[model samples]
Every structure is written in C-alpha cells, then in structure tokens.
Target: MSEGVKWTVLGDDDYLEIANNGRKPVKASLRIAGDIPYYGANNVQDYVEGFTHDGEFVLIAEDGTKSVDNYSIQYAVGKFWANNHVHVIRGKSELNTKYLFYYLQTVSFIPFLSGGGRAKLTKGKLVEIPIAFPPIETQNTIVSILDSFEELSTELSTELLNRGKQNEYYRDLLLTFPEESIEV
Candidate 1:
C-alpha cells in the first residue's frame, strides 16, 4: 500500500472537471450556498448551490491574476465547484484530497507564463505533475493540525475586526465632541 500506488489523470473522475482555460466574456451572477463552496482562481470566493464533484477534492485556479504563478498551488477540499478559471483535482482511494492539496501548495508545480503577462495554468500540465503521497494516517494528522491552525487564525481575524470597530466608534465619539471656542 505504501509503494507503487496507481496514479491516474484528474480527468478519470467523471464528476470532477477542469475549468475553462479562458475567462468567460461575461461574469455570471453565481454564488455558493449550503454545503457547496464556490472557488475562484485565487481562493474560495463564495458558497454555491451545488458542487460538480463529491467527497474531498482539490481545486486550482485556471486563469486570472492569481493564475500567473503556475506553481502557486491554491487547493481546497470538500464539496466545491471548479469555477471557469480553476482546475479540480479529484483523488482516488490511495490519495487523500486534503493531503494532496496541502502538498501541492508546497511544490513549485505551477508553470511560468511568458510575455510579462498573467500566467494561465492548464489541466494538461496539472494532471501530469508529480505529487508525493504519504500514509493515510499521517496525512490525516497533518490535515488535522492545519485545520486547528486555521480555526485559530479565523478567531484572531474576528477579534481584530471587533477591535477595529470599537476603535472607530471611540474615535468618532471623540471627534464629535464640540471644540472649545477659541478666543478671537
């Protein structure tokens, strides 16, 4: 189980598919809700109605400002949709989607775009890229640790937002106080 694991192209998953290489001419009024996480080229932008794939899977941006770094690995798991500018990497039994997602982030797999322009990542290269696989238990542990860190980071962000609001309120209150009349 540890060695010679079978590797397949991402297209093997019928439900999961790569996003269109080019951006849509018009932006769709799409949004994710419920269990579906709508992913964009850069990151998870919003919640969507439904996901194209089931179970844990990885998503990579296909095109956009963030897609320039072919090696800029931005991956996420759970039910999600690969937006027009993203690539969905589904995992088989041998590989864990979360583990693959995190691993991809650490590797320089993204291809460089030329002509001093935004890089566009394609599915062909993504599927052929080599990824390291560890034991399932080990992968789970790593994912768990990362999840804990994420929770803490989120809490800190909320605290910072609250503090900012409180500061703003006090500043406004102080500014509103009438200035003492200056002697002419």
Candidate 2:
C-alpha cells in the first residue's frame, strides 16, 4: 500500500518463475541413476537422474517437517536437485531472489499447509500467498541493511568468544602457585 507499488499474488504470471516440478519417482530414478555419492543416498537427487533445477532459488520445505509459526527455508544458487518434499522458486525480471528469501521468513505457512498426518504446502496454495511488491530499489536496500546486520552479529559473537578465552587464561595464570613441597 505505497506509491508506485501494488500487492500481487506470488503465482501471478507477470511475476512468476517458480519450479516445483520435474522430479521423477524414486523407484523409476533408481533404474537410470548411478553413483549415490559419499554423503550417502539421502539426497533428493539420488532418486532422480541429474539435477531438476539450476540457478538461484528460495527453497521451502513442502512436507514432512513444520512448526506452528515457521518452516525451513534455504537459499540455493547454481545447480541443485530437489524432490517433492521441497518447493524451488525464484523470480524472473520483476522480483529479486534474495528479497524473496528475506520476505518469506516473515510469512506463516500454517494457513496454506494441508494434510492430516504430515503437513504439506502444496504448489496451488503456495502461488496464492500474497507478497509485497515494493520498488526494486527498496527491495535491494532492505537486503543490504539485513546483510550488514548479519555480518555485524557474526563479528560480535567471535569477539565475545575470544574475550571469554582470555578471561579464563588470566584467571588460571593468577591462580598458579609457586612450586613447593609440604610435609604432613
């Protein structure tokens, strides 16, 4: 609700570039695939031959895991593989990938998720989630501010750990006693 900006559904064709398809059945993939890798055959790719997606994407868990307020979100760049359990989405020209990643953190998936035994965020419902479409410059600015804060937080944590180690060393040095023997 700002000047030069309007609200739009995420799945709107004008701004859509989502990828939650191309995954093959695990049994079918096994017949054509090879070399499961050293990390074991747990990767979503193991069930399929080759990669399903390439380039930047904001991956959101589709099933099997959930919390009341949030779900797992991962930002992936370059080539990667995914199964039905994750939804790989990205922006085309109008949207920015990093901006979406940041924005999704504030979204609540509980409203859109379905299923009784296992929660799932289906593709049909995901496209309907409303998103803010501020100016491109604003999106970039927000990302920059957030990134700077993250970097500073990491630096402060490291400094605190170093100071704790120094405190322990000084305490030990001050407590050291001169070498002496005592008779009982």
Candidate 3:
C-alpha cells in the first residue's frame, strides 16, 4: 500500500479471460506431443496438439497443491492451452500485467480459500480479492525493478547448478583408483 493507492476488486474489466468457452478440462491421456504448453493447476503438465490462447497472460492455479501450499502463479507467453483447473488472466493496459502478477504472488489466499482437504480458489473468491491499484508509472517502476532482480536471481541459480556439476566431475575424477590397484 502506498499514498494515493486505491484498493479495488478484480473484475471482468480489469482482467480478461482468454480460455476457451466452457473451460474444458483436457485429460493427460489425451495430450500429445506438440509445440503449445497445456497448463493445469500448478504447472504445464504436457503439450497438446492445439492451442486456445496466444500472447502473454498470467495464470493462477484454481485448485490443487499450489492453491493450498504454494500460491502457484505463472506467466505464459505465446500459444498455450489452459484447462479448467487454472484461471487465465490478461490485465488491462492501465494495469501492468506483470505488476498484477507479482502483487497476487504476495497475497495470502488462506482467507479466501474453501473446501477443506483440497483447498480451492473459486472464481467468486478470486474476483473478490482486493487489488491495490497504483498509478501506471509506479506500477511500471515496480515491474522494472522486479524484472532486474529476477534476471539476476536466475543467472545466479544457473551458475550455481553449473558449479555443482563441475564439482561432481572433479570429485569423481580425483577419487577414482587405478585399475591395477583393484583385485578382480
């Protein structure tokens, strides 16, 4: 929250759903190797032969582990197919889509979630979550800062993984005994 920031509910005008009519759930068995990602509650489980939406949009997991344990939020660019278990959202120009995506990640869904064992973030509950709307310039600045941090974080993670692999290779090479030293 910031000065002049207004809180408002996320409605149809603020975000648009590009998912196919009826929001059909594609079964895993029916999925085939393809170029487009088939998104579910937590992540992309498979690739489907066809795509329903194109361009950039934010995906919020409607149910499953992500809904309860980890607020599973993701961004998809280019062509993709979304099942009934995810809510596809594209923000209006006034609102930076990435800004909204980051804001939602910070939100706690526990208060809004229902259905005990398998917690769910229903459409009604999703829409009711208040959005802290800031000026476009402020939103852009926040997005830019976050984007830089994300790039740096990703680079560090990649470097760490590469180093781990390099370490493993050297360790194995140094510890190996000569064939003559081993008895058959």
- Residue pairs with backbone atoms closer than 3 Å in model 3 (clashes): none
Highest lDDT model number: 3
Clashes of 1: 9
Instruction: List TM-score per model, in order.
Output: 0.65, 0.74, 0.86
Candidate 3 Cα errors over 4 Å, as ranges: 1-3, 12-22, 181-184
Which 10 consecutive residues of model 1 have the lowest summed lDDT?
A: 18-27
* Cα lDDT of model 2 by residue, 1-184, tens digit: 5567657877886876777665433444354554321111122334334566668888777776646466777777766566667777887687778888898889888899898877778889989899886787788888899889989999999999999999999999988866774344
The residue-level lDDT of candidate 3 at 143 comes to: 94
Question: Can you write out model 3's per-residue Cα lDDT over 17-90, one digit (the tens) per residue?
Answer: 43535345777787778978888888888887888778778888888844454588888888888888888786
Candidate lDDT (C-alpha), each? 0.61, 0.71, 0.80
- Local distance difference test, candidate 2: 0.71
Arrange candidates by TM-score, descending. 3, 2, 1
Model 1 clashing residue pairs (backbone): 32-47, 32-48, 33-47, 33-48, 62-85, 68-119, 70-110, 70-111, 71-110
